[model samples]
Target: MSTYSYRIVNVFTQGDDPFSGNPLCVFESAESLDTPRMQALARQFNLSETTFMLPSTRANARVRIFTPSYEMPFAGHPTLGTAHVCRALGLAGDTLTLEMQAGLIPVYATQRRWTLQASANGPSG
Candidate 1:
């Protein structure tokens, strides 16, 4: 088997610079986060959302969004947090098109923040 690498991130999603409340849990990777394991962590952390990075052909990573109970097609916070983590690891470009089940959602990074939004005409990439 091939070796895979990933990281777990804690994101506030909202609030001030210092941050408050529970930080969102994320298992970021170029491969994939263990499915059952990621679910378990979601339960343990109990954040609004969590992210898993999967293999992708896009310059941006293929990402899966999950809640504590089930996976999601798309989510604002999870996308942002995932982008932020990836950028921090020097995996970012001016723009990234995350391959989500919903579509090829584009995320752009500016200064120190990451933002994700959907497009009606976006390709299923």
Candidate 2:
């Protein structure tokens, strides 16, 4: 197996719950991605959350969100925080698509912060 190359970046994103502190992540990426390595990366960060960026064989970038415990399909803070890091690291565009386990998540961004909207491709109520 090959190594998953990732960049550890610190970020902050406010969640609905006031008590929920800003999430952080050590964004991981490489030629391939898997669960065990993803879990290990999350553990290493030991933050409110972590993420792995894996571009899908189909289209758009596949993003995996993880807490210290288990992986999450769609998360507000993780989505925003990862976008922030991706943009900061010059890996994002004005508008980008995030392919999470849930589905295709469209992300819009500005110079300062990122805004996420949930749709059939993503989270919906």
Candidate 3:
């Protein structure tokens, strides 16, 4: 038998209404899941994106973002959403730095909203 837990949140919403924003599924402490399982979970959720939280030696947490079809190194919505989840779960403070494949990204939050400092990836061919 096996068990995994997740939380559903709507990011970038207009207000307190849950349905106003993009829905995301976040898995906490997903260190045990391998790539295939993570992909499967993301597909199962069928949301715009899904995030898996993992342990990080360099940042507050390492996050893996995935869509139903593929994985993304860094994404705006997931980054902000994950940071919000981290704060809510007490894994982070008002500010959070997430380690993604692109690099370490910082996020700051207030009572009303969250902000992320994302570096430009440059033009993609």
Candidate 4:
């Protein structure tokens, strides 16, 4: 028997309203979980998106994004929200570069808000 840690956060939320933002589930230190397990966990959470934090040799962290139904190479809200969680967990610094299947996504954080860069390819991430 084993257990993993996770956190729930609100992404792109309006001030002071818990229901205003897109809810995200971030699985911390998820290097042990495989794709199928991650997908199942995402389905169990049933949020718009869920993210898994993995150790990265090239970037600050490697992020895997999943919906209830499938995996995603990259996503916007999940990226930002996951970055916030990474910083909070000491897994990354204030500015983070996340390695994803699509590409490297950079995120900058302030005390209150976090922002992600739009890749030259487009805004899909």
lDDT score, candidate 3: 0.88
Q: How much is 36 displaced in model 4, in angstroms?
A: 0.7
Model 3 weakest 10-residue run by lDDT: 116-125
Candidate 2 vs candidate 3, TM-score winner? 3
lDDT of 2 at 21: 55
lDDT of 3 by residue, 1-125 (tens): 77898889888888567788888899988989999999999999899899999999988999999999999988889988899889988988998789987888888998758998864662121
What's the distance in Å from true for residue 112, model 4? 1.7
Q: Which of the predicted structures, 2 or 4, would earn the higher lDDT when compared with the native?
A: 4
Which candidate would rank higher by TM-score, 1 or 3? 3
Q: Candidate 4, after superposition: displacement of residue 59 in Å?
A: 0.9
Candidate 1 residue lDDT tens string, 3-106: 43544554553555545433555565635456777676667667787777776786468887778898788877677777877777677675777788777888
- RMSD values for the candidates in order, in angstroms, are 3.9, 4.9, 2.9, 2.1
- Per-residue lDDT over 9-119 for candidate 2, one digit per residue giving the tens place of the 0 to 100 score: 434425544344564664546435568877877887787678887767542467888888898888877777677666666676767777777876777887656788896
Give the number of the best model, judged by lDDT.
4
**TM-score for each candidate, following the candidate numbering:** 0.74, 0.73, 0.92, 0.91
Clashing pairs in 3: none
Residue 67, candidate 3: C-alpha displacement in angstroms: 0.4
